[model samples]
Target: MTNFDKILEVAQKRQGQSQPLKLQDSTVLLEQIKNREQDTRPLNLKHIESLAESIAVLGLIEPLVLDNKARLLAGGHRLAAIQLLKEQQADKYLHHFPDNRIPIRMLPFDAESEPDLALQVEIAENEQRRDYTPNEVKAIAERLRTAGFIDVKGRPKKGQKPLMPALAVVIGKNLRTVQRYLEPNQNTEQEKSTTPVVLLKQASTKLKQWQKIEPKTPQEKALAKRLPELLNLIEDVLSNEK
Candidate 1:
């Protein structure tokens, strides 16, 4: 069958015991979604906006499947995107029907537990998506820990990294990076900052020197710190300092 058909079939199967759809004000639903347990990687605004625009134009092509208890079994961001589209409520043209929240589509979930189902959605969405930065992957890893028995060690106690190797592979980085990000005090224990919260205060005086450069992503931001080439680049770029 077609992709839409496949998505519908999947939605129907997921919401087996629940009703076909509900246009309930899903704000509470979403808040519960945030608190309940699930994962989302660091998203560059560019990508989310693109997806939002597509939903804005095409309508929510896929229905968000909710559990028997009204918990989301899948389509977390898809629902978020749809809500944003409805809020924007711009007069964009789709195949037709287009007046905001628009009763898009919903399917009930007959899942066993919220975490069990949420994890399935998390993996499904992640498998079909792009790579994330070390920082972003850490976010996902953190969520998985709290997302229920998905962990062999039971729920992680927060700020803990998985001892498992397979998870590291999914985030597209080695396990060490995962640990480094999850380390509880990393942000507060900035060794560089403590020696001086504001280093080379005078060095930053040359606004133009810093203004022209940008670190591409977390990796680039990091490599710039540890890479010798970047040290040379920094020296060259900041040469204008008085």
Candidate 2:
């Protein structure tokens, strides 16, 4: 079994239950969690805000995991979101966290000595995730624009904060990539340029360039021998194109 599986098995043997503790009480626990130095993943502000919003509506679905000594082993983002909610004084949402307390599950592990296990658990918790596809990302960007959450320029309509950057953070994409996905005209133009005629011209130019180069390497010689066959296939494809 993997380190996480072993930890989970141990936690299960020990009842596998979570209990509530005052948020303030966790401060010392957080300080004691020594794995922070190994955690290189930066905390995303937009992601924290999104989490806070969900937590407000649905409450925290997953309880934070802790070690035997009450040191944090996972759920850093959830903890940050809870702290943000507290700072915002969101009374309605804070109702779930009665007396400023949140649920946490403790595993019977020695975090101080088992540093590798602690780091493994932390990595397993964070890395076992999925991301949105390019099409889904485009759809989400379009929906946000249509909803007026973002303007034509991909900035917030009224607020000073730029929506694109915030969105980039939330979606785990760079600003330029998000911007490109948001541009309908750019996407359409790219589609238009992929016609059979355009492809044929591009391929023919590349073939001529390859023919001029004298093949030196074995790989190059092999590829040069197949160029004539490749040209025939390209010609057939173009001829069949409507």
Candidate 3:
């Protein structure tokens, strides 16, 4: 079967149940959608700009998928492109977009529950992607484990469903291959050598967290103001370490 067929099969089998598609403000959805930790896919600025241009003319062909609270289950790149377009205030597209609301397919969810289907959908969507470097895979795996999708030993977390098996399905790899990528060795020579990529991921995570910080205190305000310089210094340190 073709790759699209495989993706459709995975989506149909793993998505549990579907809900009716609805319209939501892109701006509001942007605010509410929480990105998956495992979603470490790098954004392509050229691709995003090209997509925004196409969207301006052809309009959105596919709706975004989200959970109940507007947390993104998939379509990270698409959402990013739309946000970019909005930031530029693309007037030609605005007439077609209408209050900046885009179509969405909302998935079933419970915030307090264990291992919602949203994660399953995320893995499925992630599987359809390609061209990830070894470093990117390892970094994504680290984030997945840290988010409690998997345990310290790289097994699925307690009360959480099996991630490796599902990931294997999406990734089209054998369980062992998937395991090797998902489970990192603490003292491995390769890991020690790839420290810079790992440090880069941590730095990116810190910047994301900083975005959420309120900056109420004087120290916080100072840190906020100098965040760009801090990031530049961090980059220099990483380069020297490398």
lDDT of 3 by residue, 1-242 (tens): 54434434444455463643232334443456666555546666755764564455445645677766667767776777777777775685576577656777665453224244555556656565554444555564454455444433555455773445434433336667766664446337566666877868697678968868788999889888988887788777777766
lDDT of 2 at 54: 51
Estimate the lDDT of model 1. Answer: 0.47
> Any residue pairs clashing in model 3, and if so which?
none
Q: Comparing 2 and 3 by TM-score, which wins?
A: 2
Question: Global CA lDDT of candidate 2, please?
Answer: 0.64
What lDDT tens digits, residue by residue, belong to model 2 across residues 178-237?
A: 777667676566666876678786988899798889999999999999999988888788
lDDT-superior candidate, 2 or 3: 2
Q: Cα deviation in Å at residue 188, candidate 1?
A: 58
**Candidate 3: misplaced stretches above 4 Å?**
1-34, 37-40, 111-116, 126-242
User: Model 3 misses residue 179 by how many Å?
Assistant: 37
What is candidate 1's lDDT per residue for 1-242, written digit by digit as tens? 43333444556566573533332333233333322244465434444444455544334444555544655555655655554554565454222233222332232444444355445554564455444544554555554445331344655676544333434534434656656656776656555464431444434444335545787889867755555554455566556453
What lDDT score belongs to each candidate, Candidate 1 first? 0.47, 0.64, 0.58
- Give the distance in Å from residue 24's predicted Cα in candidate 1 to where it truly belongs: 17
Off by over 4 Å in 1: 1-37, 40-44, 93-114, 125-242
TM-score against native, each model: 0.32, 0.45, 0.38
